[model samples]
Target: MIADLFPHAQPGAGLIGGVMIGLAAAIMLLGLGRIAGVSGLAARATGIAGSGAPHGIAIAFILGLPLGACIVASVTDWKPATYSAPLMLVAAGLIVGFGTRLGSGCTSGHGVCGLSRLSWRSVVATGLFMASGFATVAVMRIAGAL
Candidate 1:
């Protein structure tokens, strides 16, 4: 196991992950003046237009996520797992969209970008998002719907 292989490790993976994400956010903010907010991009992509910066960067970011996954799969002998069903996936998407709108931003926005700026609204939203997620998972596990 990965954990077993690095028993004396100092969370290098998490550190690298945070550094990479910070670099991405910094690059986006400095180079494009964008907030790296996913909800803003999703809104623009769906024709809700508030800021065009998030729209463009969000488009690139969203598209690149799957592309990166594919690249990893191709190079690392990773076999992707299939989802339960197309309808379930669609329902999940709708629910997530609703949650994003209600929460004012997605996790990437509120949790990462917003929290980085020490925004109170973002902190509340992130807390709510996380709590809701935890509740959902716990309920689903209890109901055997997980």
Candidate 2:
């Protein structure tokens, strides 16, 4: 489906990205005893979370997200993906922030870390996340909005 949409199926890039993510998560766990959850890190970075990783670390991690992308794009033929209008982007971000709070963590936390650790809660949460994503896409497609 992605190839259908973009025609550029970069499996090597996916592998590289997956390996990098796993390394980052592993480093956070083994070196810092923290789960590499972007949502929690974001909250911590913004002082919304009262307690968690150090503020500096959170800020660095959050900043590294886009910075890393920029670095890669500089070296490789990587083009930043664009979504919708600014208003829609902001609204989607707010909704995702709320959903991350409601769901207890983002995909990185529950889907990768929690699932790897055999957490039943994460399993359920990830399942619901996938289902909701599918449903949303289905609805959007039906409405000719996808």
TM-score of each: 0.77, 0.89
Model 1 Cα lDDT, one tens digit per residue, 1-146: 65699887758757986777778778778888777777677677666756565455667876776786688678876676868678978988999888787677887788888899999999999888899889988998999977
lDDT of each: 0.78, 0.91
Mind giving the per-residue lDDT tens digits that candidate 2 earns over 1-146? Answer: 77777777877778989989989899989988999999999999999989888999999999999998788889988776878889978988999999997787989999999999999999999999999999988998999987
Q: Which runs in model 1 stand beyond 4 Å of their true positions?
A: 1-15, 50-58
- Model 2's TM-score against the true structure: 0.89
Best by lDDT: 2
lDDT of 1: 0.78
